[model samples]
Target chain A: MRVGELSRRSGVPIPTIKYYLREGLLAPGVATAANQADYTEEHVRRLKLIRALIDVGRVSVAGAREVIDALSADGRDPLDLLGEAQYAIAPRHRPGRESPEWPAARERVVALVEARGWLVHPDSDVIDLVADALSAGDRLGVAEFFHNLEGYADAAVQVAAMEVRSVLARPDPAAQMELVVLGTVLGEALFSALRMLAHQHESARQLGFSPPTPADHGVNPAP
Target chain B: MRVGELSRRSGVPIPTIKYYLREGLLAPGVATAANQADYTEEHVRRLKLIRALIDVGRVSVAGAREVIDALSADGRDPLDLLGEAQYAIAPRHRPGRESPEWPAARERVVALVEARGWLVHPDSDVIDLVADALSAGDRLGVAEFFHNLEGYADAAVQVAAMEVRSVLARPDPAAQMELVVLGTVLGEALFSALRMLAHQHESARQLGFSPPTPADHGVNPAP
Candidate 1:
């Protein structure tokens, strides 16, 4: 296949495909002539993955490049590869002047990790994320949100365990790595949507509204 | 207090605070004179909330305005206010041309909601979110990811229930609405970070690596 067919089949514009190629996000096609190149089914597959990462997964182009590089790199441990994907997708945080609340937040995070007996890198972006949320909660006077932490952690661990099991079951390392990356990225979106739906259900119930039956169209009034 | 003191107290720069003021993300300060405005402690509080929503919660300027407006709207039902906040923060999706897989994905979501006896609106953003994720998983050939859906839903419902209980416990409608907005936004970040940490711990355990103790520094040896 040529770039034109690749673009048509992948639903990506030719210019975008060319940009991806130039950005090292897509592997270079075989140079068939001075102005043309022949792509393979693998290229089609790679293009789709790139679209999924950037479009659906909402990863930045640079992040997608790192992820693709990590995916293509052979002989790396699966766990390390997973770490690289996590690092790549993790939101970048600007360093801020140390605040009065950070120490307490850090201590709380450390205590939570220790209490759970979960081993994670001390420098993991998650550490900063957890601390940031805690600090923000404290400042906003919503510290009660942390009261739900234990429950959230329990659910988080269960989902994480299931994900690790699924990833480990894959025989091919490349396939396993791809799953780790996509699963981590898209999985967040999935969980978020589900959580919102669950909130709607729970809020309705708490407010004494009955569940809406299928018969209820546009306006789902409480029965 | 005045705008300058409010800026100093909130750690938000004066110009940015002015921008937020201009954007209607923050309420106007009481006009004491033609050129000067007097801001109250309430102004300080509102400024912090705006910062948390925009900076930490990552809500857009327009979205933040909707949220603040929702909070300030008197005599609105708490549940309705929460719905507004959720809508403000919901990821906007562009409608796509109908595809073959969408029917199946939509069916799966509908069935999941029915089975769970959830009363969510049929046209809820969350429905699209779930369907999109399902379609993306199918295209990515990771359909097995749905095998974890039940577990994920269980966890999601638990967290959602906790959030609702906390919101309902708040006596003030405005405060309750503020929490709903901040909780939905910041809570997502908190959960994602926790999930990553949990994944790290689970992956380490599955790979036969021992848990890291606090004393163990830099080099976490792979066993």
Candidate 2:
């Protein structure tokens, strides 16, 4: 169909469609004329996935791009595809460079990390991760910080493994897939919000402070 | 004390400390001479916070900078400070442009969201969110994706609220802060990994696939 027809058929607006073309998020329709272009069913499907990632998953464009590329890669079965998608969204220490002087302080932190025996890679990424956190009030000593994080990572690994094992233990295939769909799609957001709440409450307890009020919008307020 | 002494005291190494200084993640120790510099207690504390954020929280250097600045903002209460930190670590979408060529497809997804009466903001962000997801193999015509995500978000909100309420219900401030650290530091990693497993197992069931042998990790060897 022509652009207008494509818009009508797809329910996306014209100007917005133009923007997608510019962003490389969408390819332009076939040129029927100098000013006209045609779209296809594939376009409709693609547009929907993009929307799902952005609107529901709340991933950024760069993040979403990575995810889409992963999905397009071979070896993904339908049942496992969603699971892979979840991995792409999994949280990790985002890495970037810091000022040169930051490394002196970083080494101190790294030693503490090593002494504590946390399973972290000693990459430049670690430097980027630690460089910006220097100013928070609840500053941890090197020993204390590494010890705390290692404990936390260990606890997390155990809990997550248990939950997943339980989910997979069920016998019914339909239920299993439903669980996967439900679990992968919603599980990250659910637990992420939960963790934030847990953190705030726990931090408050350690600091001898009051736990803050919940957002009450059915959404856990950040922190 | 000298920078070397401060490094020993803080557990930060000299080389890494130098990097932190160059990155602005730390202030320069007071220079005693061309070859010597003195450091102070504040440096030690700041180094710890930086380590926690980078090493534990896994924040990027640029992101950590933003987070630290927010945490250090004068006059903000600790609760508010933490809230800001949570959101900063993972910012939510604002809005973005949509495409006209896929109006029908966009509308299908939007309508699915609207039918649920979701309070989605229509803007460039939302548009890009939808557009990028197109590559994820989600069928635009299928309503299941929207329904699934909405349901999941709802459940997540409820679970999170419960967790927070339970923690806050505690009578002691010390206990509350401890919970905060526990949840944030530990809970985030734990739940995320579980969610990933859930996706993998569930997807296999949905696709009529059998589990691999014990020797085989969940991932296919070919993959």
Candidate 3:
């Protein structure tokens, strides 16, 4: 297939596909003629992953490139693989003006992870990411959210263990790395959406809202 | 307190505060004289919430205003409150080009929710959100992610129940609304960061990497 076929197959516009090519998000196709390149099925697949990262994960093109790069990188040291995967999951935070609440919030994060016996490096940018979110909650006058930290951590640890097991089960090393990106980026989107629905469900259950039935979704029960 | 004092206390600059005020994200302070206005403690807290939504949650100014409006709206019917809170969590998705996989994925979502016995409306945008994410995973050629949907939904249900309980425990109706915003936006951020750290910890444990010691974080473990 050429660019048009790739675009049609992938449902990405030609110009945007060209843009992704220019941004190195999609690997170059083999040159066939003047101003023409032959794309394979892989190009179509990569385009979808790029859109998933940009549209769903809100990751920058640069971040997407990093993830794509890590996806192909196999047989690396586990620590190095973890380093790149973490970077892809949460892009490094830019330096910003520090709030007065930052230190205490950061300490709370460090303390929580320590209490959980997590073996992540202290220098992982995720520490600051958690701290930043904690302080943002504090600043919003919703410090009550902080009380739920242990619960969140417990759930995360359980979910992460399951995720790691799933990824490790992939037979191929490249497939393993690909699952890392999927489980990190799309996984969050899926989780966030489900969490929203779950919240609505819980609120309804607790507040006496009637349960939605098969009729609500066009499913008819037998008479 | 005047606008200047409001800026000082809130740590938001006067210009940005004026921008937020003009955007209707912050309510207008009491006009005491020409070219001056007296703000209140409520203004300071609102400023923090506004920044949290914009800076941390990446909500647009208009969306922040909607959330702020919902925060002050009390004693509404539970369904109405849930409607408004759901909007606060997810700014409505704009219509976009649909992929071929959309219908099947949407059906899968409906089936999952129905199986869970949730009481949410069929028209909730979150259904489309989950569908979009699922199809994005399909497009990315990671259909293996679909297998984990049940697990993700499981965690979401448990976590959402805990969150709703926490929100309901708030004595004030308005406080309950505030917790909804905090739990939705900041809660996702907190979860994402923790999930990343957990992934790293799990990867290291499963891959036989050595754990970081107290010295790694400058805490000396007492022998």
TM-scores, each model vs. reference: 0.93, 0.48, 0.90
lDDT of 1 at B175: 72
lDDT of 3 by residue, B1-223 (tens): 9887898888899999988878878889888999898889888877877777777777778888888887776677655676676676574553232767788888899889888788777877788888877877776777776677888888888888888888888997776877787678888888888888888788777776655576574322234
Q: Please identify model 3 stretches exceeding 4 Å from their true place.
A: A72-75, A89-97, A210-223, B72-74, B91-97, B210-223
> Residue by residue across A58-115, what tens digits does model 3's lDDT show?
7888888888887766678655676686687574553232777888988888888777
Question: Considering lDDT, where higher is better, how would the candidates rank from best to worst?
Answer: 1, 3, 2
DockQ of each: 0.63, 0.11, 0.56
Over 4 Å off, model 2: A1-28, A41-45, A51-76, A83-191, A194-223, B1-31, B34-36, B40-45, B51-78, B96-186, B205-223
DockQ for candidate 3: 0.56
Please state the CAPRI-style docking class of candidate 1: medium
Better of 1 and 3 by lDDT: 1
Full ranking by DockQ:
1, 3, 2
| Alpha-carbon local distance difference test for all models | 0.80, 0.48, 0.77
Candidate number with greatest TM-score: 1
- The local lDDT score (0 to 100) that residue B20 gets in candidate 1 is 86
**lDDT for each residue of candidate 2 in A10-124, tens digit (9 for 90 to 100):** 5667786787777766767889888877789767655655655565465566665566665555654443455445545544443223434455546654554345333233442
Per-residue error (Å), model 1, residue A168: 1.5
